[model samples]
Target: MNSTAVSVDRNRTLKMIAREFYHGLTSLLFPAICIVCDQRIDEPNTVVCHNCWSDLKVLSTDIVKMKQIPEQLDTILPVFEFNDTIQKIIHGLKYSGYKSSGVHLGRLMAAQLPQDFLLKDTVLMPVPLHPLKKRERGYNQSMYIARGIAEISGNIIRDNVLNRVKNTVTQTHLDAHERHANMQNAFAVNRSCDLSGIYSIVLIDDVFTTGATMNAAATVLKSRGVASIRGLTVAAPI
Candidate 1:
């Protein structure tokens, strides 16, 4: 090889070595543990250990009914039952800032979709957090999950297409009726975006509780001329 080409190759190799060494030091200082089982994770960018991941209980392939789902939502698909393991994984991602957790869960969520779930022109939209809440959390867990789904499914993630106009109270302690009330009119579509070619949308969220939030998001999209809207979530109450 020419001198210049040889120099470039040497630089590339040195850079790769430095990057791996940095990652190795980081891992040693802050070991990655399985979100579910608390076992040490040797593989990079993995949330759950191999055993816990395999032990995760996937809901049956059949579509399950969601209580209080909005009429605007054509379907709601949840990958796992809201069991202890799933709960911890979600809590880590949503509250603990373990962002890598979303990648595994999101891929599982995408894998659970039906063979024809996403149409050719389907867009993935994550449920938006109110600006203040987003600021407090430092990140939107749903958006990260949607990104993971996009990574696996090759679907476009249109996060800006929807906006949460209302800063509602947390729904964690709310009853079914209270949740519906709190989420009413919480979302609206961004009028500036040209969604002309999008045939369908898969609304993404971290969890499906009373379905109030997902339904409210779907309502906004329907009002903005979206025809078909579906919901995808990591876990739901069984």
Candidate 2:
């Protein structure tokens, strides 16, 4: 009934219409194609087709539970195996800047998760990227993944709570011990963050390798009074 409320509604409607028009125009001019299969896809937001998506192997609950959990984390939830189609997808998301793909992968993970996997009031947080790495990458790939999970699960996201203070060398080539050492003192709780009523958090990432990154981040979160901390990723090695 108020003029301000009506104006806000009008603006929201205009934005939806504009978004639809842009999608329609882009789809018409350059139809979306599946990256894995190279088949034309109607969905503009995703680069991989449904068939290719299904090609990713789901990790059994036993494997997920048995995976080496960092001492600082309460649990680890890995949805898919880090091989084949998923490997290609993560490669594109991390190396080629296909952030939408990361989001899609997170959506897939949330959809496939068991009914009682995530605890109530569990906030989702992406592992922080160092300032230098973030500048070079333009965006944090795990943030988009967390965004997708939030979209599907209706969970809150807290991106500013954890901060990456150390810009260590990439762990891709590092052995297990090397990775553990590389991530030491890499993260710290944000100085202004008050962990008052927040009890649980799930750190999101694209893959679970040695879990060195999650371990480092969780150590910082636990030290800051977060009661429950867990790790969730799209894929993990068998």
Candidate 3:
């Protein structure tokens, strides 16, 4: 009986090893391409080439923390300005089916979070997607970003705590006021969700542009008794 148990454990371990090897090989076969230049990269793990990586301007966390929110936005932070390169990359990730790029950008955003943003009991709640759109996309980009942030901050990701109740139009075309109006009544706390213990959270997203999205999300979280809410994004329009 003991021999059989040992053999089972060994098989499980081998299966895990095999899975890793297969994943590695598959990644190498495709190779990650630079979103900007469309060149095959030597590093299969990162989306941007070495030159593009160096070109990306890492926005200062201090500036973000101290930056004044415009008349409309309550709180906001963007790690990079929205330049042509950034616009191209974000467009590809959001509209062009380059899903892996979300992971890379998420990591960059994670690196820009304030040092103390990940408090002792902080949670990561990404902006939720509408049900139908999420189904079409196969996954939420914000959730992907949250996963990358989770890897670095070691914060618990509570993905299903909030959900989009309305399928709204793209915010790209809306003005600040219209954006807020469009998102009105769009999200709600999950009916069966639990929020009794969480004290703080950092809402993660791919970019911070109009600040409308973050405001709406934070409003919902504040209503749930969360004490502190901060926003983090990979790119901000600045």
Give a tens-digit lDDT track for model 2, residues 1-238.
8999999999999999999999889888998787777889865577888888879889998888789888899988888988878888888898888998888888888998777766668899999899999999899999999988888998989998998999999899999899999999999998998998899999998889889999999998888889999899999998
**For residues 37-86, what per-residue lDDT tens digits would candidate 1 score against the true structure?**
88898877777788776776877655365344666789888878888888
* C-alpha lDDT (0 to 100) for residue 77 of candidate 3: 70
Rank candidates, TM-score, best first: 1, 2, 3
Root-mean-square deviation of every model: 3.4, 5.8, 5.4
- Give each model's whole-structure lDDT: 0.84, 0.89, 0.76
**TM-score of model 2 vs. true structure:** 0.84
Residue 105 displacement in candidate 1 (angstroms): 1.3
- Model 2 alpha-carbon miss at residue 175, Å: 1.4
Best by lDDT: 2
Give the clash total for candidate 2. 0
Instruction: Sort the candidates on lDDT, descending order.
Output: 2, 1, 3
lDDT of 1: 0.84
Model 1, residue 139: distance off in Å is 1.3
